[model samples]
Structure formats: C-alpha cells, structure tokens
Target chain A: MSTTLNPGERPTGYLPEGADINRNIAARRLRGKIWQALFFSSLVIGLLALGTLLYTIIDDSFGYIAVQTKIDPEELSDRPLAELSKEELIEILRANISAGLFRRFDRDEPFSERSKESVLQLIEERVIGREVVASFKLTESLLERERIEATVRERFPRARLEFHSWLNRDFLTRPMSSVPILAGVGNAILGSLWVIAITMILAVPIGILGGVYLEEYASDTWYYRLIETNINNLAGVPSIIYGILGLAVFVRALEPLTSGAAFGVTDSNGRTILSAGLTMALLVLPLMIINAREAIRAVPQSIRQASYGLGATKWQTVWHHVLPNALPGILTGTILSMSRAMGETAPLIVVGASTFVVFFPDSVFDKFTVIPIQIYNWTSQPGSQFRNIAAAAIIVLLVTLLLLNATAILLRNRFKRSY
Target chain B: MTVAELSAVDMAQANGRYAVELHNTHIYYGSFRAVKDVSLQIERQRITAFIGPSGCGKSTVLRAINRMNDLIPGSRLEGRILFHGKNIYDPDVDPVEVRRRIGMVFQKPNPFPKSIYDNIMFGPRINGWRGTKAQADELVERALRGAAIWDEVKDKLHQPGTALSGGQQQRLCIARALAVQPEVILMDEPCSALDPISTLKIEELMLELRRNYTIIIVTHNMQQASRVSDYTAFFLMDADRAGQLVEYGPTEQIFTSPNDKRTEDYISGRFG
Candidate 1:
C-alpha cells in the first residue's frame, strides 16, 4: 500500500517503506521456483505411475517359457507341426484321440472345413499335449537366459525352452481354454464390441434428448429440480449399483424381452449380452447427460437469441442452432463414457458376463463376456500363464479404447465451432 | 410533449397514417415496471430513432414490439401494440409469426457461426421457405444486396460469418433479418459496437432501407438520431425510475427546437 511516487530517487534496492525490494523479489522468485518444482514433481509422479502400469502389463506379455509334452513331437513327424497340411494334421488328430471324440469334433465342425492352423492346434492339444511347466518375465528371460536353460535341463529334461510372445496371432484368434497357451481373446473381443454397440445405441440418443429437454424445454418446477438432483447424484453412484438395477430390471423382471424369447429365439436365459449392455448403458447414462448439458450450456445465449429473433420456433432453434454447436462437446463426452464402459468390469460381472465364454455372441440376447471381465477371470486363475494372457488382453483393451477415442476425437474436431 | 397535448388529429388518423402504434404500453420485468405508459406512432417506411440514456428501457420497449421479451423469465407486457390496425398481442397471434414479420438486429453483431449464405438462409428456412437451388441463390443475393454488403461478401459467401470484420458482421446480421421479408426491422444500437466508419456505413444503410422497410433504432448518440431518423422519440427516467417518453416529433424539431426541457438538456449534453 505504499503510495510513494518518487521511489526511483531513493536507493535502488530499497522500497519507500525501507523494505529491501530486491530481497522481496528474490523471495517471490524463490517461492515461484519451489511451486514450479512441486508441479513438475507431481507431473513426474503421474507419468511414473502410468509407466509402471504399462511396464508390468508388457513385462508379463512376452518372455521365455519351458514347455513339456506328453509325447515327443519329433517322434510323430519329421517336419514342424505348423508346416503340416490340413489333411495331415486332421489324420494325426484322428489317430491319437478316441473315435468318439473325433466324431464329436466333426459334429461340432466338419474336418474338411477346418483350416490347417486349427487342425494343427487340435493335434497339438489332443496328441502332443503341450504343457507350459515354467514361465519367466521378459526382464528375467532377457537377463537369466543361461539360468533358465540350466533349470529346464536339470528339472525338465524333456521340456523345451523357447522365447514366446503371449500376444501372438493365435492368442488373438482362438477362444478361451483351460490351457493357457490355447486361450485367445477372440470371443471376449467380440463380446465387448457387441455390448458397447448396444450400450451406445441405448444410451446416446436418450442421454442427448434428456439433456435437451432439461436445458431447453423444462421449466424450473420442483419435479424438474428433483430430476436434475437425481441425475447429478446418479453420476456418483457406484457402477455395481447400476449392475444390480440392470439385473433386476433387464435380466429377471424383463427376461422374456431381454432373453430373446419374446423374439422367438428362446435358447438363451436372462444372462445375455443385452443385459450387460443395458447395465453399461445405465452406468454411463448419467455421465452422458451431464456432459451433454455442459456442452449445451456452453453455447452462448446470444446464439439462441439470434435464432429466436429469426422467427424460429423453440424446436427449430434447438435443432438448428443449439445442437449443432453442442455436438463437438457431446462427442467428447461420448469418448470419455465409451472408454469407461470399455474398461468397466464390476457392472458387467454383476449383470452376468460369463467368466469363461468360448463362443462369440451372435445376437444381443446371446451369452457374452467382455475383455475386462476376461482379464479379471484370467488374473484370478491359479496358473502363472494366465497372468501372461491377461496382460495380452489388457493390451487389446487399451488398443481398442485408443482406436475408439481416436474416431470420436476426429468427429469432434470435424464439427468443432469457434463460438 | 405530454401525450394529451395536440394529439387529437393524430389519433383520428392513427390506423391509416402510422405503421405501428402503442396505446399506453407498459412493460414489466417481474413486479418492476421498466417502461411506463408510453404512447407513440411510427410512420410506415420511415426510420424512427428511440434515443435515451442507458437503462432507460429503450431496448426493452424495442424488444416488446415483436414479443422478444417473452424469452426472459418473469417479463410481462400490458396494453397493446398495434401493427396494420391489429393488436399484435392478441392471444391467437403466435409470437413466432410476429417475430417473422418484425425482425431485429442486436447491439452486438450476433451473426451465427455459419457461412454467410447459411446465415441469411436460416431465417427463410426456419419459416419453411423452400426453394429451388437457383431461387435460393437469388434470394441470398437479394438479401445481401438489400443490406448493402453483397459486393464485399460475394466471393466469400461460403466463409464463416464470424470471420467478417465487426462492421461487416453487423451488416450481415441486417441481411439475415432482411431475408425473412419482414415489414419492420428493429435495431438495438446496431452501430454502437462499430468504429466510426462502420457506424456511418450502417447509418447510410438505414436511410437506404427507409424506402422499402420501416426501421426503428435505439441509439445513445444524438447525432445518429438526428442524421438518420425521420422521427425521433426522446425518453427519460421519471422519479420512479420507469422510462417515459419526454418528446416525440420530427428528428429536426427534437434536435433544433425546444420542447421538454429534459430533451433540450440531454441534446445539449447537460445531463442524461
């Protein structure tokens, strides 16, 4: 509060109040430096946390594994198993297993229709009976190669040690199996796709229109206030609660509708993709509505005034001016909501995602299991190799999320407005 | 001048002589009366300037003409505003239709964040004026030309309206209002946000529009009122703070001759 205007005539380092101005400046600079350092450290902490998460997942994704087989593969064939023709592999599979099992395999899917890779997989499963007895992390495999070789030679003389990438093509294409090596995330991937598609279809329009009604059409009545309060509270409710609600409403109470019985496809019970999708839709609906409201609210009031001044009715004003301007923000909200739905496990679990689904869901009412649930299932298993496959599934989920977000971001940018 | 002074002859020919007439109109926001018991007649195809100090309810009265005040919560209007000898406030008359026939340009340039072509097309499209491609193009051209901005924006019709300069944007808003083929255009200080050059341009444009459209402008500048307006209504806040008309007559007489002492003082820059 010094009002002295002739401070320049005084000593250069001192203020009119006889305080050392340079010291004051230095102290302020020191405080700024300390705060900057604190901010930088916080950023580093966040980055380190993210790095550790990705590292652990990737560390378990690829490494060396010791495999022991019931029979020696060299004794059965001179060439590698992968190079075998479909007919040869099918013959080998037919010769090793029981005739009843062979006939069952043909009943499930004809041998002539099976590809070479699938037949080789079957022969390796039914005949060679490969078992992963020991696995090592990527860092351990890289640093302790000689020790891993020695351990394999001393303890499992018949076991072969080879570098393996758990996230291989076969892992992405095959269905779930008790054997970790044979398990793939194909069914889970498709289930996630189906559930997310249904979630979007069920949630997006309802969320957006609900926002419009609240922002544009609804008056400040007590009932509307109550609805608004409930929506805000619903956004904070646990996802598991939405799961229970979906279970009661879509799975049990409306089983006739959700299980496809009402549509004349009566094979499935209530635990279906539709129920899981509905649960996820409920879980994200509040967030969607909140985000849409924010986007719509961000549109300047003058734009609405301008539109109304042009003789546009309320509906026309909302449709032509408000919605188009709010589109980019709504799309951003969808991206965030979609990412949350993709990674969510608790709600889908309570809504009845099968822990181990082998078949792809062919309809909305078919039994399904998403990738996060699959990861949870794999991580909870007793075998060490299951962790490796879980890591691979995590990678798949992350990539799918990135691709989905990229598409949404591109759409948001396309419709972006300056005002 | 008081409403009772020398108005019998004007009231006799009110319907045929005036494009719009206010019969003791009172505007309110909630319980607060903003404009009180104001009466005036606006001649057809003439520019009528409403000059007053800030917050004297000039803008509110302007908005009340086309029912624009209905957008604000708790705002109500009493009495009647007549257009073409009919009370526009009649229950059966839709506000949307009222706004279509009497368009408005705001104090700030509020062009939509769209192409200039689309900005003009918005009014007609919302009113369900569908036309062929060529016809639509012609309409856009006519509206832009009518606002005197077609030549500057001809090559850039597809550009965003917001990309125009402040003055061009105001002109574009005028074009947007003109596209609906409104009978009257209410301008709420259309030149206030512009530079001097842009203000001159809009004044000239307003004078040009007087030939085909009835224009009502709310301005704070006395020179603008005297220069562009055919008739001027000077308003002042009463002791109760409700805005009331102090004088209404030809712009020249309101500026040069004496009427109410308040109008003379305001014109002479003594006080608001």
Candidate 2:
C-alpha cells in the first residue's frame, strides 16, 4: 500500500520494487518445487514397495532344485527310468515296494484303469521316493548355476539338478499334501470360488436393496441419518471384528442352518463353506452398501424428476429409470467388493476356515480353505519349497483380483452412457 | 379479428369454460412461503403463459398445477388447484394420477438415457399400456409428430434420446409427455435453455399443441409470452420477496395496456 506520491494520488495496489518481487517469486517457485518433489517421492515409494512385492513373488515362483532318491532308478531298470514303458515302470514299482502297498494302489485305482503317466508318477513317488534336497531362487539359479551343480554333485551323488517352476500345471491340479512337491492349490481354488459365490449370493441383493432404500425411499430423518452414519462407520470397522460377529451369530447361534442339520444332513459342523461365506459376506456387506449407495447417488436428480413427471410411481421410477442409469456403476462397485471379499483372510480364519484342507468343497456345508489362507499356511512352513508354492499361490490370487477389476472396468466402459 | 380475440369467444362458448382453476393458492417450501396468494383460471385447449423475473415462483406455480412439487421434501400447497372441477390437492387424489394427466416439460431437456422410441414409450409403458408392437410404434410416431419432431428423429428412433442435440432432446421430452395422453401440458421455461431458433420451434409447437391440449408455460422472456400465449399472467416479487401475480389478462392487453403499474414497468424493462 506504499507509493512515492501524494496521499490523494497514491495507488491502491502498488507493486513492491523489482528485487523484492523477484525474491518473492523465486521463493514461491522453490516452495512449489519442494511440494512437487515430496508428492513425487511418495508416489515413487509406493511404486517401489509394489515392485518389490511382485519381484519376490516371481523370484520364488521359478528356480533350480536338487532332488535325491533313496533307490537309484538305474539299479531298478536297464535303461533310463523316463524311457521305461508303463508296464515296466509298474513292474519295477511292484517289485520294489511292499506287497500290501502295491495291493493298496491296485485297490484304490486298478492298474488297468490308471493312465501311463499316472503309473509313472506313482512309481516315481512310491518306489523312487524322490525328495528335494536343495532349492534356489530364479535369480540365484541363473547367476550361480555352475556353483549349484557342483555343490549338488559333491554333496549327494544320487541327486539330480533340474530347473523347476513352482507354478506348473501339476501344482495347480494336484491336491494339497504334506509333501511339498505334491502339494497344489486346486482344492483351495475351488473353496475360494464356492465361498465367494455364496458371499455374493448373500451380500449383493441385500446390500443393493439396502442402498436403494437409503438413497431413494427413506425420508431424511434423524433415524435414517443415524442409519446412514452407522453404515459409513461400519465400512471402516476391522474385518476380524466382523469375523467374531459371524462366529457368534452364524457359527454358534445359527449352527443348524449352516451345518446343513436343518436340511436333514449332519456329517459336518458349522465350520463349513456356508459359514465362511457368511462371514466374508458380513465383512464385505458394509463395503457393498457404501459403494452401492454411492452408485445410486450418482444417478442425476433430473432423471428422477423426469420419470416422476411422466406419472411414474416411486417404484417404477427407481426400477425402470434410476436403476438402469445406476446399473454400470453398481456392477463396478459390486465386482470391486467381490474382489475385496476374495482376498480377505482374517475374517475367514476367525470364522474357522481350515488351514490345510485337502478336499474340495462340493457343497456350501463342506469345509473350505481359500487361496490366501493356503498361502499363509505355506509361508509359515519351515522350508524354501513351501515358500515357492506360497509365491505361486500369491500369483493366482493376484491374477484373480486383476481379472475381477478388469471385468469391472470393462462393464463400466461398455455400459457408460452420456446424459 | 386477431386469433387472440377469436379464441376469447371460443373460451366463452366452451362447456367447462376452464380447464383448470386455482383458488387462492399459496406454495411453501418448509415454513418459507415462496408464492403468495394467487388465483387464475386456464382456458381449455389454449396456451397460457406466466412471465416473471428469476425466483418469482412462476415455475413453482406451474409445477403445483400437476403436483410436481410433491417430489421436493417439505413442499406444501394451500388452497386448491382444481382440474375437471375436482381439487387435485385432495388426499384421495393420487399425485401420480394428477401427474399422468397433467404432464410437465422441464427448464432443461432431460431425456432419459434411452432410445428415442423407448423414451417416448416410457410414459405409456409405466401407465400399463397394453398395445401390440405395431400399435406401440404408431403411438410413438403420433407423439413424436405431436411434438413436431417426428421427421428429425424418425430415421434414428432407436438411437439414444440423449445423443440428440439440445433442442431435439427437448422435443423428445415433450413427445414423452404426450405419449401418456395428458389433458394438460406444463412447460417450466422449456425454451430458456434452447437457442433462438430452437426457441421459435418450441413456441410454434406449443401453438400447434394448444388445439388438443391446454398449455401453461412459465418464461422469463416477455416477447415469447406475447407471441405464443392466448392469455398471459405477470408476476413480481414483493417487499417480502414472495412472488405475487401482478396482472392476468389476454396477452395482447397485458402487453399493450397493462392495468398494473408493475406489469407495465416490467414489460417496459424498467426493473424486475
């Protein structure tokens, strides 16, 4: 407000002189740069953490392994064991193992019914008793291949060094086992599907209906406001708390319903797929309701007015106009919630999902274990082989999540209409 | 004689004389009164225009005719808005039925994100229209034709109504209202959002529609009211900021020889 002039002629917004102005501009520029750098660094840090996670998972998923056998295959066959015919392999397996063991294999799946590859696998598993003596990560396998081969040859002459990808067809198809090489995520994958299906079945309709009621029908009164506030708060509550609630309600109180006892079936208890799904449903219900509410709220008020002006009833307006306009957004939110339910582990564990389920859940009443729980179990085992399998399972979970998110994106874009 | 003077005689000869009559109506949002006591009769099958400045409650009054204000929370109306000699505000009278019979076109074109055909059919479908496919198509065509937008949209009837230009979308919305066979059409600044050409088009369409349906339009433009309306109502906000009707008469007299000083002042652009 200063100027070198008479008071009557003084300017209202006078500039400070050049040097001070330049300094101020420079200081502002420097401050802007600092904030920009800080924001960029935060982004870099987040990306670096995600990059490290992916690198470790990939590193553990493939590598080299040294396997040793108790009985040499050369001693059991004249030629290479891999070159032996299925009959020769079976004969060698019969001659080496005990009579009762061979009889048990026959009784389980008669030799005539078994495939050649199955017979060879049985022979390698039972007769040869191949065991992984050492394992190396993907990076170490490539960088120190010669050293690994030398160490394997020097330590165990019968050991065979080979490159192995933990995420193989066999690992995906075989049932879970105590033996690391024989373990697979097949059963866990099935359990995850069943649990998620039931979760969606229970949560989706209820969550959407609740959202519609809140957004469209309910009056803006203290109680409805209270309900809205509690729903918002419930979405942020810890998932494990939901698990405890599910345990008390679905597992203990509604045990008969969840255990299939109400339907005249009673072989299993309440710690079944239905119970796990119900728990996961409880964990994701708040999220679903919040997202659905947001989607429904995004529908323009003008559309509702237009529908009502056409002499449509409240239900007709919501069902025909509001719902169709909100569908894409609702589907996107639902799928995102489904992905969240797919990856949740704490709630399922508290609801009693088994850590080592070998059998697939064929019904809602059967026992279940999801992929994340399987990874958790594997990572805790005292072996690098288990770590590799855990990494593979993590890859599966990531792929599933990615696919679900992709579907959400596709549905949104495909149905997105400009108004 | 001018068309306005001729219609005045036709208005006298009509059996019912009026399509709608408002008896000392006052509109309120919550406790705040938006429109003060006002009463007027709308001649059957004629276009009536409400001209006023912004926030003068002209649109509010127009919406009250069809009970569109019911959608707004805490909005209430006092006195009676009569249609077919029955007060529409009666508890036994369903707001939905009133809306179906007295349709509205909004200030901005708000066509649903649906095909042109579907947009027109929505009103009919919701009203339990039980027609064959061919009959449905005929109904759509008649409604579109009634809005004077049939040719522009007939080729692309399956295209989304929202994909049309602003003016076309507005016409589509009018067509949608017509599909329900409403006896009255309420236009709340329908041409305010359109270009001059589109505004002229809508004005012409309103004149055509007046042959079969009673029309009430709220507009800020005085010329538009004088051009299209058989009867014109002028409103101005009072010291309390509540809108009150300043004058109601034939459009020609209201413009040329207004009885109220405020109407003359407003028409002469002295002040709002």
Displacement of the residue B158 alpha carbon in candidate 2, Å: 1.1
lDDT of 2 by residue, A76-193 (tens): 8889877878888888988989999999999999998998899988888888889998888999999999999899899977899999999989888777999888899999989999
The alpha-carbon deviation from the true structure for residue A257 of candidate 2, after best TM-score superposition, in angstroms, is 1.7
Task: Give the Cα-based TM-score of candidate 1 against the true structure.
Answer: 0.91
Fnat for candidate 2 (0 to 1): 0.84
lDDT of 1 by residue, B1-272 (tens): 11232134336654476778998999999899999999998988999999989888889889998899999878988899987766778886788888887899998999999999999999999888978999999999999999999999999999999999999999999999999998899999999999999999999999999998999999998889989999999888888889888899999999999588988999999987
Give the lDDT of residue A252 in candidate 2: 91
Error of 2 at A30 (Å): 4.9
Best model number under DockQ? 2
* Local accuracy of candidate 1 as per-residue lDDT tens digits, A205-251: 99999999999988878999999999999999998888999889999
Q: Each prediction's interface RMSD?
A: 0.8, 0.6
Q: What share of the true interface contacts does each candidate keep?
A: 0.69, 0.84
Please give the distance, in angstroms, between residue A357's alpha carbon in candidate 2 and its true position after superposition.
Answer: 1.3
